[model samples]
Target: MHVPDGFINAPVSVAAGVVAAGAVAVSLRGARRELDEATAPLAGLVAAFIFAVQMLNFPVAAGTSGHLLGGALAAILVGPYTGVLCISVVLLMQGILFADGGLTALGVNITVMGVVTVVVAYALFRGLVKVLPRKRGSVTVASFAAALISVPAAACVFTAIYAIGGTTDVPVGKVLTAMVGVHVLIGIGEAVITMLTVGAVVAVRPDLVYGARGLAAPLKLRVGGELVDAPAARPVPVAARSPRAVWATGLVTALVLAGFVSFYASASPDGLEKVAADKGIDKNVEEHAAKDSPLADYGVKDITDARISGGLAGVIGVGVTVVAGTGIFWSVRRRRTTDAAPTHVPESV
Candidate 1:
């Protein structure tokens, strides 16, 4: 959920900001090991795709809708540290460019939607994969289960944050119950989307799926009536396609989803909005600082046709987010490469 300004007081907001900053810092360091030549570009595409899919909000309960939080999907497809950065990029873009989330509450949104979701979902996903059958299908199952739990976990975190710094006086227990209840329904949608997306990626390129790496069943050999590890298989040379092809395909898909498909998203309030209204959480909500921008509210300024305005805005958002995300990841990859480069010492004369 995109928390708007005035929902939390200044002190708590600043505290969340510090927490968000620390999380991003830690993720940056961890991402160095996660992003390589094959996966670094995919990370950017993942961010753009998440930004696109989030635009297509599906109906959850009566008069309520929800969209992909992208933490599980990203973590399963990419890596957890990179997943956090991906979502944080999307939230930043939405807040500054689309005015979808408030600038003042950026930290709150990042903490709930980015850090908490990624941490909880990825941890659960790893655990489930370990216990479940080590197959491609198991990865999808784990992705679903992880995503399902992450949404409610995020809701609980938000509720706790609100309890501490909520602008309005309301029954914390009621808010917690309602938030968890509605998000559970929303979680179903999240699980399905995550499973389908992760499954698709695993089918095409399991190597690219961070969670699916090294999941192939180990080879076994029988020696002296006992089972033992077999020698490593020879590397097979398949007709390899360039990563550019995959990146191009992913970018095209993102554009299609955001540019046209988003037009059909449900108009009802999302889980967060509905709960906020029901619990009086929006009583002190303030206007977004970027509300008057040209691309504010996901529409181009002075554009009469709703379809064209929204379509242009969506396309622009995808373009900008992809570029920004790619730049960030490329720099991270470069830093990693530079760090890994060998350093030579001068010979003693």
Candidate 2:
């Protein structure tokens, strides 16, 4: 959920900012180990896809709706470190461009939504995949559970943050209960979306799915009435194959979802907004600093047609996020290459 400005006090918000910055720094380093020529573009696509799916909020309860938090999906498709970067980039774009999340509370949102979700979900996903059958279906199953748990974990983290720095006088108990209750329902939506997306990719090309990698069992051969491991097959370099088909398909899907399908998404408030309004958590809510921006609230300033304005904004958001994310990831990939290159020393003449 997007935490708006004034929900948390200045001191704690600043503290969270420091924590967020440190986590991002760590992730940047870790991502170097994860990204490559192929997966780097995939990571950028994951960010744009997350941004698009978030616009299609599905009804969760009477008046509450839920959207994909995307940590599990991203972590499964890419890697956890890159997944954190993916969600963080989406939140950054939404905050500065769409004026959706709060600028002041950016750290809080990143900590709860980006860091907490990725850590909890990826850890659980790894554990489950180890115990379950090492098959493609098992990865998808583990993804479901990981996604299901991550949402509530994030809710608990937000509750704790609010207890420490909430501006209102509301009881912490009520806030926790409401946040957990609604988010639990919301988690189902997250799980399904994560499951389907991961399954689809795993089905098409298991090589592309980070979590599904190495799941292919070694070939076996029967010789002299005994079974033994077959000779290792020559592996193809990741850089040799083209990822253009998958990348183009994913981009087109994101474009369609944002530009056409989002119009039918539920208009009701999301899980966090509903809980906040019900629990008086928004009593001290402040207006967004970018509220007057032309693209504020996911609509163009001069475009009067609701459909056209929202579609254009969504398209623009997808484009910008893809470009920014790709730039960042490609740079990281290049850095990885630079770090991995062997240095030469001249012999004494």
- Which candidate number maximizes lDDT? 2
TM-score of each: 0.96, 0.98
| Total backbone clashes of candidate 2, pairs 3 or more residues apart or in separate chains | 0
lDDT of 1 by residue, 132-168 (tens): 9888999999999999999999999999999999999
**Per-model CA lDDT versus the true structure:** 0.92, 0.93
Q: Candidate 1, which segments miss by more than 4 Å at Cα?
A: 221-230, 235-241
Compose the digit string of candidate 2's lDDT tens values, residues 118-221.
99999999999999987899999999999999999999999999999999999999999999999999999999999999999998888889888888777889
Candidate topping TM-score: 2
- Candidate 1 accuracy as TM-score: 0.96
For model 1, how big is the CA root-mean-square deviation?
Answer: 1.7
Worst 10 residues of 2 by lDDT: 235-244
- lDDT, residue 173, model 2: 93
